[model samples]
Target: MKFVQPIRDKRKIEAMKKVLKSESVRDYALFVLGINSGLRISDLLALSVDDVTTETGNIKERITLKENKTGKTKDFPIGTSAHKALKEYLDTSSLETTSPLFLSRKGTKAIRREQAYRILNNAARTVGIKDKIGTHTLRKTFAYHAYKSGYDLSMIQKLLNHSAPSVTLRYIGITQEEMDDVYLTLNL
Candidate 1:
């Protein structure tokens, strides 16, 4: 498969949010959760209403899921932005506990990975993002911003289920400029 880049520009990200938010609550929440939680598109699409919402319709602090590819149980907290969007979605829709969090156009099944890609790709294009964006871009974007914010490499590696920090660094597209700065700044 061809490579896809993260949505690295902050302004582009904000523009994407504006587009999705104006279009659909489900789409907005999906993008927000993808960027904040770092889940794969498959995992994100597989989520059910009960995964993120409580019986009383409040967004849960933590979401738990077993990864389809890895079969590993993962749990992560929902950040304020994702939580707010999720709450808005839940409040606006009459979803049942077992209903898929993201429904297809027919409303009978969870949205496919291709559909998720279309949703994100269309938003990215609308915001003038020139990068090669796809469903994987969401996960990469999460890692990119997390690393940029000074999170430990090993920590991020483990969070992304990557085998090593080197892999995480390469996956997130650490630039030559940033690497050179690291070398220039550290003194003996």
Candidate 2:
């Protein structure tokens, strides 16, 4: 399969927030968590309410997850934005420790992977993101933005739990144009 590249525009994020329903703060959390935490969709979707939130509605320091594909234990730190989003979502959602972090409209136990894609894609459309944003978009967005923030590829690889830097770079879809521009503006 040809690997798809995620849309990396910051404005798209703003547009997504604008289109999201006020009551569906869970959607907001999903987007924020994916982009900020760099957690895979499976791991993110697998989270229960208690995994990330305290009973008092505060975010925990770290979330421990057993990655499905790799069979490794990974810990994700909670950031301010993700914490805030979680708090807001919890206030409106009836989720419990046994409930999935995301749920279906019927209040079912789980949200299918396809539903996750739609939540992201619909929001991306509101923000004018033209690419085919899918389940993996948020993961790629997190890595790309982290790289732009001056994090090293090796560190990113480790954080992503990738076996190699090349895999991590490819996962984030770093283009040849971006690579070529690195030395174009060098000073004496």
lDDT (10s digit) by residue, model 2, range 2-82: 355565777777677657645377788887777788888888888888888777867788888899878899887888888
Where model 1 places Cα greater than 4 Å from the true spot, the runs are 184-188
Candidate 2 accuracy as lDDT: 0.79
Alpha carbon lDDT at 104, candidate 1 = 73
Give me the runs in candidate 2 sitting further than 4 Å from their true place. 21-23, 55-57
Location of the lowest summed lDDT over 10 successive residues in candidate 2 = 1-10
Candidate with maximal lDDT: 1
- lDDT computed for candidate 1: 0.90
Error of 2 at 66 (Å): 0.6
Please, what are the lDDT tens digits per residue for candidate 1 over residues 55-167?
78788889999999899999989999999989888888888899999877686799898888889989998988888999999999999999999899999999999998889
